[model samples]
Target: MAGNGGHLTPGLVNTRTHLFQAGLRGIGEGLGLLAWLSAVGEEAARLTPERAYATAAAAAAEALRSGTTTLVEHMWPHPSSEVHDAVLRALKDSDVRAVLCRGVADRADPSRRWGFDPRLMQPLEAALAHTDELIAQARGSRVDVGVAVPNPRCLTPKGMGAVRAYAEGRATLARHGVGVSYNPLSNMRLGSGIAPVPEMLEAGLSVGLGVDRAASNDTQDILEALRIGAYLQRAVHRKADLFGFPEMFAMAAGGANRMLGIEENPDGGVRAGTRADLVLHRFDRDHACLPVRDPGATLLTCGSSRTVAAVLVGGEVLVRDGEHVRLPSREPAAGLARRGSCGG
Candidate 1:
C-alpha cells in the first residue's frame, strides 16, 4: 500500500487580505486604530505602482506557499494604473487562484477626522471607471475584478449613493455574489469594534472570513484567523462552543463559492466532477501530532502554515513537500515587469 504522510483537506479560501500591506508590517504596533492610521496611512499614501507590484508578489508567494490556494485580495488604491496592473501580473505570474477586489474610498474626509491623509481618497467617478475598465480587462482571465467599499462610514452620503449605483451596474463583481469578508480580528486590533458577523449571518447573507490588512493581522496565515475568530465569538457570547469546526471549515473552504454564484458540488470535494482545490498538512509529526482523535479539533487548535506539506488547486500541484513548486520563480516577481499588467 502507498502510504500518505499527511492529512488531506480542502485548500483554504482566504476571503480578504490587503496584500500591499505585506511590506508595511509592524508599523504601528502599540497604537490604537486611529493613531495607527496616521502612521500606516502615510505609508499607504506613499506607495508607487512599482512598490505595489513588489508587495503583491511577496504576498502571493507567501499565500501559495502556506497552502492557501484561493485568495480574495482587497486592495487599497494607489494613484497609478501600474499599481493595479502589478497586482494582476503577480497573481498571473504566481498562478495562484484569486479574486482581486479593487477597494475604493471616495471620501477621505472621514479618514481625515482620524488623522489619515486625504490624499488616499480617489474621486468616486474615477474609481468606478477604473473598476469597470479592470473588470472588462479581466474577462476570461483567472483574476476577477470586484468592487470593494473599504469603509461605509468613510464615504459621504453622496459618495455612498454613487457606490450603490455603481455596484448595481457591476453586480457580477460583488464578493462571492452576495457576500462580504468579515475581519473581526483586524477591527478589534484597531479598536474599530467587532464586525457584526452574527448579525450579518442571521440576515441570510453569505459571510466569509478575512484577515484584512496584513499590517493589522501581521501575518497571512488563515489558521490563525479561523482560531481567533472562533475564540472571539466564544468570549463575547460566554459560551465555550459558540462556533464549531464545521462552520469555520465551511467558511474557509467552500464559502467563497457561494458568492461566486456557482451551483453546489454535491458529489463531495474529492469525488469526480468536483473542483480539485485541496491541501495536505503533516499532522503525523511535531506539534500537529498532538492527537488524531478529532481531526477538526486538532486542525483548528494545532495547525499553522508551518504544518502545511502540500497544496493542489484545480488539479494542479502548486506546493509539494512544504515548498512552492509552480511559482514563476523563488524570487518575487522575477521578470514580471515585461508581462505588463496581465491584461487587467
Candidate 2:
C-alpha cells in the first residue's frame, strides 16, 4: 500500500476500559461518580452472554477503528462464565491485543457507596478460579487474562490476601513497575477531579492514555483522549509548554508497556526489530488536518479516526482505508442501540 502522504506511527494502547458498558452509553449524563454508578448498575444487572459479546465486539471495533491496537478490558465481577467467555471471543475475533482483567470484589454493599455492588460481587475463590480458566482459554490468542479489583475499599482483609497471592508474580504493579491510566474524558464526565499527570511525570511514573468505557466516555476514541489529556494538564498548570506532542504521543502509544508487562520497542517507533503495531494517518485526507506543519503537533491537535488510513497489528492489516477488514460495513454499535430497551 502506498503511504499516500501519510504519517506512520506506533498504534495507541488504551490502558483501561470496561467494554461491557458499550451498550450502556449515555445512561448517566450530568451526574457525579456515585450517582452515575447507581444509574449504570441498573443496566449492568441485565447483562447477558449475548449482550456481552455484542457490546465487547462493538467496543473493540471502535477502539481498533480509532487506532488503538491494544486495550486493557477491566471487567467487573459477574457470576456467569458464559459472559466472560463471550467477551474473550469478541476480543479475539476483533484481533486486537488485549488484557482481560476479570474483576473480584468481596465487600459487597447494596448501596454501593463504600463497597461494590452486591449484584456483581462473587466469592474471591470463584473469581480467582474463573480467572485461571480464562487464562487457559486465552493461551494461544491475542487476548490474555488478569485480575481486576474495583478499589481497596471493595476488598476484605482476607480477600486482599487472596488477590495478592493470585497476583504475586503476575501483572503486579510493584513487580512490573507502577503505571497510571490517565482517563481524561471519563474523569471530566463523571465530575472526577483532574489527575495529577504533570506531577506523575515529574515523579518519573509511567502514564498511559485511556478512554475508560463507552458508558462514561460514550466513545472509544483514543485520539480524543490524547488531545484532552495534554490540554487538561496545560490548562491546569497555566503553562502551554507542559506536555509536548511527542511526549503525549508516546503516552498514547507505548508508554505503559512496562505496567502491562509488554516489552517496549527499543526506540518506541518504526524500527527494524519493533513490533508492527502501527497506524497510518493521512493529513491530506482530512480538511482539519491539512497544511500540516509539524506532523506530531497536527496529529495531537486535529487527528481523528477519520484521518486514520490504515491500522496494522502484529503485521496484520486489521483496518485498511479506515475500515475494519473483518467487521461488516454496518455499524457494530447499532445492535447495542437496538437492544437498549433490554437494559431499561
- Tens digits of per-residue lDDT, candidate 1, 60-171, equal 7778766677888877755666677778877776677888877676565534562225676667687778877887777776677776666666677887788877766755
Window of ten residues with lowest summed lDDT in model 2: 169-178
Cα TM-score of candidate 2: 0.96
lDDT of 1: 0.70
Candidate 1, residue 206: the lDDT equals 76
Put down candidate 2 lDDT per residue, 1-344, tens digits, no spaces. 57868899888899999998888878889988888988877777778888888889988988998899999999988877888999999999999999899989999986777788998777789989988899999989988788888888889888999888888856433354578999999998888899998789789898888999898998999999999888999998899987778888878887788878676742346667767899999877789787899998998999889988899999999988878888754757466767563343
C-alpha TM-scores of all predictions: 0.84, 0.96
Q: How far is 103's C-alpha from truth in model 1 (Å)?
A: 2.5
Clashing pairs in 2: none
In terms of lDDT, the best-performing candidate is 2
Show how many residue pairs clash in every candidate, following the order shown: 2, 0
- Residue 290, candidate 2: how far off, in angstroms? 1.2
N/CA/C clash count, model 2: 0
Local distance difference test values of all predictions, in order: 0.70, 0.85
